[model samples]
Target: MRRLVIVNQKGGVGKTTTTANLAAALVRRGWRVLLIDMDPQAHLSIHFGFDPESNEPTIYDVLTQGTSVTEILRDTEEGLRLLPACVDLAAAEVELAGVDDRHYLLRNALSPVENEFDAILVDCAPSLGLLTLNALCAGFEVIIPLQPHFLALQGLMKLGQTVALVRARLNPMLRIAGVVVVMQDSGTLLSAEVISGLEQILAAHRRSGDAWGDARIFSTRIRRNIKLAECPSHQTSIFTYAPKSNGALDYAALADELFGTAAAAPVAPADAAPPVAAATTRDPRDAEDAAPSESSMRTATA
Candidate 1:
């Protein structure tokens, strides 16, 4: 099974939205998908129609109490299964603080059921804390959802550094599958400039034969669509809420681009290696800036 972590330290970049919709799109295409909500906010669970207050056996129990992920997995309308989250998860950081190998806790928790689904998408919190580190170490590929803003690119650099550190010290097989630009407003000149800047950075990385060699910038950008923002309130995916809308189409295209038939050709395990590290060293200030700001969007019911 291929594990993908939807991560971005910067909030408001559509990480949860992308994770929810991508899982939905993959399910619509006949893939068995499991979405693991690693975020303590439980936004993903709520988006999938689960009530956070229900105190159902959630990912919190699965991670801390050694509960089975299968028990927590809830089937959604579109055939997507979600490993629900609860507010109790917020205490995990403090609870698991003294535990040994905290970063590998998630990896160990998920290893048993790794083969149960075709794809496992982890919706990480907007931080490079223990939770995000666990998600990074647990997954084989990282999918960063970026917003086309001046500071978005800066956050990507910091996230890239953290990924590199994880790869170098923990998960040797981890690689960046792609950078997805989400909530993109094509009509804005700033958005256009950000896109061009991303293109140039990607191009330079491609040429450097460094940490970002295999990393790709997805061609299918997720445009800003009201339908996407509205679906979560109704506890539905874009596919079920507005299949013909731009939001649905973009995610479908993204799914196709992620795991297409041509790219399915199997190769020897020995041939797979982590992407080369980027030559760009991360500035410490970048990390501070990439951290979730106080004004970060909270998961609030409308």
Candidate 2:
């Protein structure tokens, strides 16, 4: 299975939206997908109509109270399984501070049920706290959701440094999958300039052998779509809310690039092992062909 963490410290860049839609798109292509909401806001849960205040077991229970992932698992109408979160999850960092090897909590909790799904994507909050650290530890591939703007570019260099630190000290197999440009406005000169700036920085990282060496800006730019923002209020994925919308088309194209297609889906064992054991035979895609070429990026996005 592909264990991915969709993360970015910058808010309003579409991390949660990308995670939700990407999982839905993957499921639509015949893969069983699981979503883990590591964010304390529980926005991911609410996107699927899950009640954070319904008194049901949640990811907070699993993190602090030793609840199994299956206990809190909820099925979406669109075939995705979710590990919902709530406001109470915000306290876990403080609660887990005193524990031994706190970083491994998520990696450990996932081993038991990871084999049941073809993909597991974690939605992290807009911080580099303990919660996000746990996600970095558990995930093998990191997918960064970026916005093509000058201010947005500043945070990526810092985020890349954090990922490098974590890879060296926490998870060696961890690598950046790619950057998905969201809320894109292709007609703006600022968008083109920001994308060019991104290319230069990433190329430098590659030459310097940094954490973002294998990363690239995916060509599938999620255009500004009101339906994407609207779907969350209706408690459903964009695919189900507006199948013919730009939001759905963009995310579906992303899913195709990431997992290929139904006939040639991502290659992983049906009954895969845990992160520690599975790291030995890491996915080749994790470290290959993701670096974006300037010409190709422009050809596709322009």
Candidate 3:
């Protein structure tokens, strides 16, 4: 199975959105996907209509109470499974601070069922705390969801450093697969500049024998779409909520790119239930920016 962590220390960078939708996209390609929500906010869980307050055993229990992950896995209408999270997870960092092998908690928990899915996507918290560290230890590939802003650009360097530290101290096989720019506005010059900066940064890392040495800035950039921001409120993925929207199209292309395949032959059932009404709105943000023409799109062959 391909174990990947969708992470960004910078908030509102679309990590949760990416995790939720990418898993759905992969499932449409007929790949079994397992989503692990590591964020204390439980947005990923809530996005799938699993209310965290239902007094169910969650990832927090798996990590702190010696509960099995399989016991808490829940199936979603999107054809993907999830190890949900709850608000009580916010205390896990402090609770496990003094625990031995705290960093490997998630890695160990996932080992038993590693073969059950084609991909396991971990939705990490925005902060670089113990929760994020556990995700770093558990996942082999890191897909960073970035928004086009100067501060978000700076946060990439810090996140890269965190990945480097984790690689050295915990999981040596950990690598950044690629970056997906989210909430992008292709018409903005600043967006293009941010993508240019990212290419330069990634190129530099590739030259330095870093974790992202083989990484590329993915060509399939997620476009700014209100449909994407609104899907979670409807408790479904973009593909399910607005299959004809730009958000669904972009994510489908992204899934195809990730798997080295053409557009996915739709595998969803014809009688699948229609999505619920979209009501709430997230704070709008820019999606992925442009990829420089000269930027390396191929992963450097090891």
Candidate 4:
């Protein structure tokens, strides 16, 4: 299976949104997918109408209690399955801190059933904590979902260093696949400029042969669409809640771009989203993404 961890230390950058829709999109392409909600916030679980409060067997059980994938997997109407998350997962990092091999818990948990699916997508919490480390150890590649904003830009270098540390100390196969720019505003010049800056950063990393060296900005940028945000509350993916909306078209196109072929061709972009706002030429704040201490990173990689 193609095991991928969708991660970003910054919140509200479309990690859950991308994980939900991308899994849905991949399922539409006839791939059997397993969605793992590693975030204790349970947003991805709630996005699919699964009640995390119902005391279900969650990933928290998997990591902390040794619950098998079958015991916690929730079947969805779209044919995709999920190892759902609960608010109890928030305690996982602290609970597992003293445990031996905590970083490999998730990797070992998936070993039994990983072959049963074509793809496995894990939605990580917005922190560089133990839980996120578990994901890094389990995943073969990292898919970073970024927002087209300067503040979001101010964290990629830090995340890249985290990936480098994890790759050296835990999972050598771990590398970045690419970046997906979400909530893009074609109407805003700042958004365009942010993307340009992102491209330059990725280009520089490629030259450095760092952990994210191959990470490129995906061609299918997620346009700002109100429907994308609204669908989560409705407890379904954009494909199901607003199939003909701009949100649906963009995600569909992105699915096709990421996966070789999709079962459903993207329909024409719809007008269901809010009208693009007029471009306001504002300069993005020039902030820096703090990398890990050179000594620590070098020690890890050495």
The models' CA-based lDDT, in order, is: 0.78, 0.81, 0.82, 0.79
Query: For residues 232-279, what per-residue lDDT tens digits would candidate 2 score against the true structure?
Result: 998888878877666777787788678775556544345522111111
Candidate 4 scores a C-alpha RMSD against the true structure in Å of: 9.6
Candidate 1: deviation at residue 284, Å?
44
Q: Say which prediction, candidate 3 or candidate 4, comes out ahead on lDDT.
A: 3
- For candidate 1, write residues 101-137 as lDDT tens digits: 9899888987777777788999998788888888999
* Clash pairs detected, candidate 3: 181-288, 182-287, 182-288, 183-286, 183-287, 184-286, 184-287, 184-288
lDDT (0-100) at residue 12 of candidate 3?
75
TM-score of every candidate relative to the true structure = 0.84, 0.86, 0.86, 0.85
Q: Which has the higher lDDT value, candidate number 1 or candidate number 3?
A: 3
Per residue, candidate 3 scores C-alpha lDDT tens digits across 1-302 of 68899988877788999999888877766677899999999999999999999999999999999799899999998788999999999999999999999999999998898887878999998899999999999999999988775555776788899999999999998999999988776566767998999999988888677887888898888877778889999999998888767688778777767764533333434553333222222223323223324222221111
